[model samples]
Target: MVAAYPDDVDTLVAHEPPINAVLPDAAGAARARAGFYEAYQAKGTGAGMAAFIAMTSWQGEFTDEYFAQPAPDPAMFGMPTEDDGTRDDPLLSQRSWAVTDYLPDAARLLAAPTRVVVAVGEESAGTYTARTAVGMAGLLGREAVVFPSHHGGFLGGDFGYAGKPAEFATRLREVLAD
Candidate 1:
């Protein structure tokens, strides 16, 4: 929105956007993504989530060693081993790849009047989204603003992955106020 209608936006806070092109090994990330999707298609949500977790939790770049690792077991992550026989998951499927594959236009963003604040969770250090947030900030010549909790910091307990939503909101308010 900032790129197309910069004047319309006052402040744009992009929190941990998973833009793979920002990563050093974007191709490897895509391969890793395919690995998870294959797992989802072959097995189920459990296996796919396990692979996704493995990919996201990886500390550094997706190396050959990363690919060489054994396929993550759904049971290891307390996920169901049985296949639900359904696909079309927005997260585990190729449908969401466009989101991660987007290459931000730095020139247009920099030229915009909107204050583009790229945010990363404090607990998301060294993770894929964290790196992307930093990279996005770098593209705009700024540092990522650290928020509380993990990737879904602003989310409540509804998703079974509760974060510091109150604190996150407070911090967001602070940033927006600035």
Candidate 2:
């Protein structure tokens, strides 16, 4: 939006967008992503979620060691081990791969009037999205603005992953005000 309709916005707070193209080992990352998708297709939601967790929780670059790890067990994460034989999951499937594969147009965004503030959670340091946030900010000749919590910081307890929503909101207000 900032690149296309630059005049329609002022401050664009992009919070921890998981653009794998921004990573150093983008090909490795894509491979790792495909591994999880494969897990989903082979197993079920449980195995897929387990693999997804492993992928997301992995720190630093996607090294050979990352792939050498054993396949995650669904029961380990308290998930079902049964294969329901369904593959329409939005997150586990390749449906959202385009979003992660997106390579941001830095020059176009910089030329725009919008102030793009790439944000990452303080607790998400060293994570994939955090690194991408930093990389995205670097592409814009700036540093990533630290947010209050994790990736889903703004979310409430309804999602079972509660974060500092109040503090996150306050920080967001401060960032937008600036």
Candidate 3:
């Protein structure tokens, strides 16, 4: 039940040929055409073509709407960093990009869920994954809550699951129960 980008899911399940490689085929072409129509209607020809190009090229970028407002305090969040101290790992970067790429689909799933909560480790804001989680939560009309670490700091290098799983679980249970 974990929702993710079509491409990310492909990565997880090891889909061959990748989803982007098939867009020019019959069904994909039709869908693309329809998508262009919709985009043009909403945003005009130039923006629509831009979107279409981004879609086909797998170069979709994240926007503020993909994140929540009054974002979790940055001081408390810490995204995963490379050994060189850069917050850019290939997989994590892809996850972030995929989240942005498939936002419309994710929004649909969020709308259908009876209950949804977006959680991010206080340490990942501004990073791709954190931003994705924030964006997804915003689309779903859910609040993004940052749980404190064992040391009471907000940031950790782990993917929002660092420091005291039990406490975090308990907090999550409480939130869900409410």
Candidate 2 lDDT tens digits, 57-173 = 799999999999999998988889999888889999889898898989989999999989999999999888888898888888999999998999999998867889999999999
Off by over 4 Å in 2: none
For all candidates in order, the CA lDDT equals 0.92, 0.90, 0.39
Q: Where does candidate 3 stray beyond 4 Å?
A: 1-101, 104-107, 110-113, 150-162
Root-mean-square deviation per candidate:
1.3, 1.2, 15.1
Better of 2 and 3 by TM-score: 2
RMSD versus native structure for model 1:
1.3
lDDT of 3: 0.39
lDDT of model 2 at position 25: 88
Highest-scoring model, lDDT: 1
Instruction: Please name the candidate that would achieve the greatest TM-score relative to the true structure.
Output: 2
Candidate 3 C-alpha lDDT tens digits along 7-116 = 23311111011222222232433344345345444544443444344333321233333222232221232421112333333322233334223324444444443454
Q: How far is candidate 2 from the true structure (C-alpha RMSD, Å)?
A: 1.2
